[model samples]
Target: MQGGVMRRRLRRRFGLGCLLVGIALVVAQSAAAEPRRLEVELSQLFDRLDSGFSNWQGQRLEFQSARPGDPTWYGAATHDRRYGVEDEGVSLGAAVPLGADWVLQPEAGHTFDADFLPRWYADLRLQRRLSHGLVGALSLRRTEYQASRVDRLALGMERYWGPWRAGYTLNVSDVSTAGTPVGHALALDHYYGERSVIGLRASLGREEEGLPGGEAITSEVTAVALRGRHWWHPEWALSWELGTLSQGDLYDRHGVQLGIRHAF
Candidate 1:
């Protein structure tokens, strides 16, 4: 009996020890032209496997419907918990071709009733295809709450070499009540078999958190994640991710998310 208990403990730790999470399942999470991507995901925290896989304090249910195009407009709704508090929000976004090599993306989200989650958030990004199978992007985001606001700027570059892609991003951020912080992230991914992919990411940075009663804290954070998806059928895919995060003397997080996706 004792040994069985020990095994269970090890099972949980193994996944946590590997690394935390990501905007994982690459091809399975994003829709392709004329095909739609639908996913259901679960993690210990509100971890959306988006381009920015930032984990918040609550669990969430999210759904997205992408419009028809190479990379077009999409809408999403999220009912998530933040710092153990619950909140809900809906978002709409679009990606428009600026020219032959450039694209512009704009998005906005709002919560009917604000809580730990922001009352509203918005962002705009510009991406350009560069020489030598490379892409570059710049983005700015603003998240507003009842009493404080957070702003962020990011610059990124990515390179494609055959079936592999490598990317790096730099982020600078400030909060009305917290200190400024900078972060760095690196990612590598391999694609094959029409719509299957495997990816790994690592990030390190300083983070700011607004506490209750207008207080706040700043800390250093480190995270690593591995995510992948395999399509067993033309219309179905299996997705999974493992991740871990270390925060300066605050807490250590290790978790996983398993999802099923459908292409329609």
Candidate 2:
């Protein structure tokens, strides 16, 4: 009888232990089903910014279509076309993260135009996040244009405040025909809710023209862009953007773009 009693006691302890283990597993599975705190997105854009008047009363257009993907690593391909002119180009780029706080981006492109020789260009960029709200970047670009070559370096900084973000870019460039010039740009961006954003950007720069003794010219470019997006499900979204660009002695150009994106 004592042996039977001890056997029942052992069986009870074993079953109780299994019951506790099953409850713990249920709790772990519930926790695992919760949403993640971080998010990653990939997107593509088609942009058209144009302004100019010609002797033939034609408008100049710069259109670009690009497919870009972003994760821990990123990549992009872009095709650029000019209207009323036989000029077009394509670019491919990639970005990789080096460590916790730094990223490296490298890009290359080729351009073909009737007025200019086939040109090749390459760029490299380094970026780091300084804090929760601040980021900094440095970039360099080299291009071979016709009989001349151009090299440029740029520095940029950005700050994020709540839903509003602001940034600046400074650039210096050396052209084989026109020496060197410095340029500056400023921009402001606002995010509305989770799926809408608006931005205004302006840039003032000095560029060298390789004609009539290659003089330097000052130019200002201004733009305003608004974008809206709607999420149909967890992995799908519909997006729209409207933008305008204006410059001196140039006709203002306006554009509208719409697309759908899916995340995996």
Candidate 3:
């Protein structure tokens, strides 16, 4: 993860994580945002990026075994780029809950960039129920990306109003490439029925970078998405998302995702 590629990888992971959470919540039962019993999930996402200079296509696959408030393990594979000099990799990780309000996740993987590089990451989060319809979370995360590393701190809050739920997240990251990046995300969801939901999400960010010879560059990123999920039976659910991204004014991308989950 050197220079521009590092930033790209970080952004991709950010968007994917958010999409997964949104989908799970939408497909959840009326009383919970995730399956309370043993569950398995599979997901796929595809994106195309156009930067007026080059075109990049990305595809990702994820599989997970989950049990709410317990331990969960996941595996993911990502392929991004059309040319031979693309980024492709696989990751494996696990999340374990500590007590009622804390979760710790650790992951290790490898990526085949110019060569093969080892990657590892860890996340620790604390979530609390604030009031009748409010919840808040604070988290810290670190990623060791080949030659570069990133450290991030984030805060998030969610509020429930009637059939609607809204959330906001703010984060700052210390990137090994360029400098630091600051971002915020907003999400709004409406539960149409007991087992169906629709959601809208948007995110914005600014990253500062330092070039050779003391030059500086500022990168801006924006993402917007629409998603929905429904449970057709007590044990099966489906989710989908469509999204677009803009990196500065020259780069733009569009993506689609689909997922299925089953509880036993």
Residue 117 CA error for candidate 2 (Å)? 9.7
Model 3's TM-score against the true structure: 0.70
Task: Give the TM-scores of the predictions, in the order they appear.
Answer: 0.74, 0.59, 0.70
Q: For candidate 1, what is the lDDT? A: 0.57
TM-score of 2: 0.59
Q: Report how far off residue 93 is in candidate 2 (Å).
A: 2.2
* Model 3 misplaced regions, further than 4 Å: 1-38, 53-59, 66-69, 72-75, 82-84, 92-118, 192-195, 207-218
lDDT of 3 by residue, 1-264 (tens): 000000012225333343222222222223335453544555566667665434445565655565444456666677655322466777766555555444455555555552222255566655554555666777788765545666789899877667777889898888776578898888787766554677788989974332222223447978898877666886787867788877676567787877776657
For candidate 1, give the lDDT of residue 59.
32
Off by over 4 Å in 1: 1-71, 210-217
Which pairs of residues clash in candidate 1, taking residues 3 or more apart in a chain or in different chains?
A: 19-243, 19-244, 20-243, 20-244, 21-243, 23-49, 58-81
Q: Write the per-residue lDDT of candidate 2 for residues 80-196, one digit (tens) a residue.
A: 223334334554544444544565667666655523323667888777767656668788988666666778899987776676667787989887766677777676656554434
lDDT for position 1 in model 2 = 4
Could you tell me which 10 consecutive residues in candidate 2 have the lowest summed lDDT? 1-10
Question: 26-90 in candidate 1: lDDT tens per residue?
Answer: 12223333444443333233343333334454333333343323344455555654354556667
The lDDT-based order of candidates, best leading, equals 3, 1, 2
